[model samples]
Target: MVAVTDKSILGCRYGSSQPQRDTVLYADLYREGRLLLDELVTETYPVEDFAKAADDAHHGRVARGVLVF
Candidate 1:
């Protein structure tokens, strides 16, 4: 299972939860999502760079790893 939550000052959404006990896999998925968002912003919102705005969302998950509960 996978879950995401948004609890930031500007309201960002990131993070993922899985039932599996694989830290590497979770990290890979999280990184992929971050890269995707980065690319999306670089291509679409070059001027505003809204993707950076969601850094906190991604950072929170990366810092804590995958949530198993």
Candidate 2:
């Protein structure tokens, strides 16, 4: 495993049944879905071109890159 030297880098469990494991704000969730429907959140990428998606993400070209089946 690669250890990040940046102190600003933090890690946390995103979703867990454990109490206080992660609390997703309702407004944030609603906004995410709403933005997606409005084509403001992200764009879908073809599954076959996954490498391109990765490259775009590495270059900070996307908010969220989804591979469509």
Candidate 3:
């Protein structure tokens, strides 16, 4: 199961009951330079090119993208 709780800002998958713990663990990993989130962003585009970004994402051309304003 997967869930996201706004109050705790927790997101979990695979039936994890300890979402809070997972959040902390991930935070620690990021701080330790183990989680490379920037590498996941394969593309970035200005908000003006939102349509292009969306298209690329839909076409599987973009693995992950950030739309900047």
Candidate 4:
């Protein structure tokens, strides 16, 4: 993987700069790096478990967690 540059950090990543506070962008699902995981997903949790997921994320136990109905 390549290191992110200042320009990339400003452009590709959002909400990092104070000047961008007023800029609004509408992104398409696919265009926003959204992907279809389908059955490839490994874990899921109920919405009530969000606190547990938040703790896991804070502790670096997982990269991400999903809450579902």
TM-score of each: 0.19, 0.44, 0.56, 0.40
Q: Which numbered prediction scores highest in lDDT against the true structure?
A: 3
Best by TM-score: 3
lDDT of 2 by residue, 1-69 (tens): 989785695667744445443234544666677423446547788899999999998999998888889
Quality of model 4 by C-alpha lDDT: 0.61
For model 1, which pairs clash? Answer: none
Alpha-carbon runs more than 4 Å astray in model 4: 1-42
Compare candidates 1 and 3 on lDDT and give the better one.
3
Judge candidate 1 at residue 48 and give its lDDT: 51
lDDT (10s digit) by residue, model 1, range 7-56:
55664344444446556776787787843434333222233544543463
Give lDDT per model, in order. Answer: 0.45, 0.71, 0.89, 0.61
Which of candidates 1 and 4 reaches a greater lDDT? 4
- Order the candidates by lDDT, highest first: 3, 2, 4, 1
> Cα deviation in Å at residue 10, candidate 4?
12
Tens-place lDDT digits, model 4, residues 1-69: 988676543354444544443333323443565644444444577999989878887887766577897
Candidate 1 Cα lDDT to native: 0.45
